[model samples]
Target: MSAPLLLILIAALAFLATHVLYEWLAKRLLIVSGAEYLVLGVLLGPQVTGLFPPSAVAAFEPILVLGIGWMGISAGTSLRLPRLVRIPSVTYRLSLVESLTTFALVAAGATSALAYGFQASYAAVMLPALTLGAIAVASTPAGLDVAFGLSARAGARRAAPVLRQIEVAHGMDAFVSIFAFGILIAAAHTQVPLMMRALTTTEWVVVTLGIGVVGGALFHLFLGSERSPDRLFISLGGAVILTSGAASYLQLSPTLAAFVMGIVLANSLRQPAPVDDVLRSGERPLYYVLLMLAGAAWAPGSNVVWWLVIMHYVVLRTIAKLWGTGIVTWINRAQAEVGLDWGRALMGQGRLTFALALDYSRRGLPYGDLIFTCAAVSVLFTEFFAARFVRSAVDPLLVPLEQLSMTLSATTEAVMESVTETMAQRFPALRKVDPDAKEHEHKGKR
Candidate 1:
């Protein structure tokens, strides 16, 4: 085998191993620090080890982009229309609120970092551009998955129900973030042709929606239930691979395109079993790939970048989230269900930071190294804080089940008595027939 082939094989295995370790560790740690794995990958990457050199890593750039695109699409597929339509008004309102809050926080944080110490004018322009683009758009469904799984394990069904809600919320947020990014990139490009505006504007939206509809229809017609579980799963993966490649070749947004495919497949208003089966098979692998790429993409920088990162990650971003979340709540009246302050506090940054930082570096933006440093750290902190907040929510389903098993025996008995009385009152003849007898029967069944 050629040296290049050997190196590629070694790097691929190393990347996979790092991701597996991170997944294992993320489950065990109280802090849930998965972002560290990505940092580790960078430290061990060719940039440092002279194993897989800069040129070799550069070769993976297209893969990284396609992987990210698939990640977004897969994330979107999870947003079944039923959940989305559950609180259409609420979803729309909260999505706008979450997106704006994230954007404002990232922008302010980026600007403040520049004001204080980011001396390089080139770095300043790129850092805010990259960070703002990232912070505004990120939503970590993986973190939310951890929250839901834990809640299920702890017997908090009520809390677990919130999982679907959060998924829908994150999906909408991702769409908005990506859409906003498309606009931002368009505006930033000086030589953008007038004709390309259509590509960036409503045309993009129409194409995305159209792709989704077609994909969904095809899934509904042929692949819905005819194939075996394994084949059905592989078919979906094949579709994503094709769509991603096509999008990449066309210089179109693969993330948007792939997501539309998922949305289309899942939203066909048909049986959800096929869609569910496909997700069951392919979702985890895709997630692992996306996350590993994310970690591999992190290119650490010098002291200047580290200092700026600290400033933006903690101070500026935090202030922006608090302010933006609060204002959004006030305007949308979402405080009735989700506390204004709490929700604002929980709108922490993550994946989007990595995506945008990679974009900055790939595009050869000046001082892009500093942007990656700041983004990686901010994602680390945000994951920690956001996971904690989500874990703390009162899941009504989870509560009742746990109480029935352990903490609420007495209350359960009292509730049983009250229910008996109400049933007796509502059904006089049945009460006469045997209220006490029925109570004994119920207790015996339990």
Candidate 2:
């Protein structure tokens, strides 16, 4: 194999090794210290250790887009209308209020800071802030996943309701963020005239949705009465890859287009099981690769202004999450307790934020580096603390029950073993006739 291919192979192997270590010894590390993998990418990347050259990284662009497209589809699955209808109305109300509040506050603050505080030009101020706002709206699913695990272990009765609310809120916020970012990206093109530009954003959205729906239909048709797992994987992957390529060609959001395709498959078809299975199986590896690439490309300069912008962005976004959640909880008294603590759940940032930041950097937007760096830093802080806080909050509720469950499990196992031993001693003839008699009898008894 050639040198570039060799480097790519090495990176893949490294990812596998790191993933194993992460899974076996440090599952929380995967969620909290995700940026460390990115740092590894940087070390192996062109700018640092030069294991992978810039040209090689550029060549891997298709894979990056594919990773992003997969993330979008995963996000899309959460927004199925049927699922949304089942969610509580209060969940919907709280999700909308909290997401919109964050978006509005971040946009307003970033725009003002960039435009007046930094004396940035028109595009520089408005575009970056708008993009940041969209990114700011995303809360990591990892936090909720961890929370669910804790709730399950603890058997907290109230945990399910809160988890459901967070899930809906995070899903809705991601959907809105992708849509808003698509429009912002369309509007960023200064070459287009005002009249045409007004139509451009709509046109892109239409084109994206159109591609997604068409792709979904094709996938559905291909998978008809097919049960082979390989075929299902290939078909779903092909549709997403094609849709992502088309979106990229049109300067639209591949993630959004793929998301639309997922939504289409989820809502428009009868048998979405195959598609869902394929997506779940592939999401993790793609997500890890995407983060590593983001780290490789990250190059935040040590400018005081940029640092200040990042700090302000984080502070304002946090305030928005807390304040908005508080207000919504106050209004909806039924779920007031859930609403109050919901903001803590929203602290983590994950795939969507990194995906958007990578897209911004790829687009070469003004102050893009600053925005991307801020996002990276934000993810590190939020993912680390959010996971800890959610675990701490929910674990306490579960400790007593968990201990009781463990004690009961231990007692039952010991009693069974003792009974088996007693039976073996009582019927030595049975053990002689069938050496495994006690084990088999124990299994039967259980």
**CA RMSD per model (angstroms):** 6.7, 7.5
Clash totals for all candidate models: 11, 1
Q: For model 2, what is the alpha-carbon lDDT of residue 303? A: 71
| Model 2 pairs whose backbones collide | 154-398
lDDT of 1 at 138: 63
Once fitted onto the true fold, the runs of candidate 1 whose alpha carbons sit more than 4 angstroms away are: 1-33, 108-131, 150-168, 186-222, 273-277, 280-298, 303-306, 326-336, 344-353, 365-368, 384-386, 393-412, 415-446
C-alpha TM-score for every candidate: 0.71, 0.81
lDDT of 1 by residue, 1-446 (tens): 33468346645655565456546655675244445546555654565554434555566665566555556556666667775566657646665666666676666566655655656564446545444644455666555555545343543442333443455556666776665654444334333255545354455556545655565566567676654777776676666666655554444455656667777766763666665655644444433344445555555656665676567556755664466656765777755555455343245555544564555455555556666666667676677656555655434433465577775778788899999999989988657556789899999999
1-446, model 2: which lDDT tens digit per residue? 24467457745854684567545433544244455667776786767877756666676788888888888888887567776787778778888888988999999888887887578776668889988999999888766554454344544543456656667778878988888887787676434354544456667578778887787778767775567789877777788889888887767788888888888778876666766777766776676677676666667688778877888789998898777787777888844336366676787887788888887878777888888888888887787566665665445434565688899999999999888889889988554465488789989999
Cα lDDT over the full model 2: 0.74
Candidate 2 local Cα displacement, residue 33, angstroms: 5.2
For model 1, give the 10-residue run with minimal summed lDDT: 155-164
lDDT of 1: 0.57
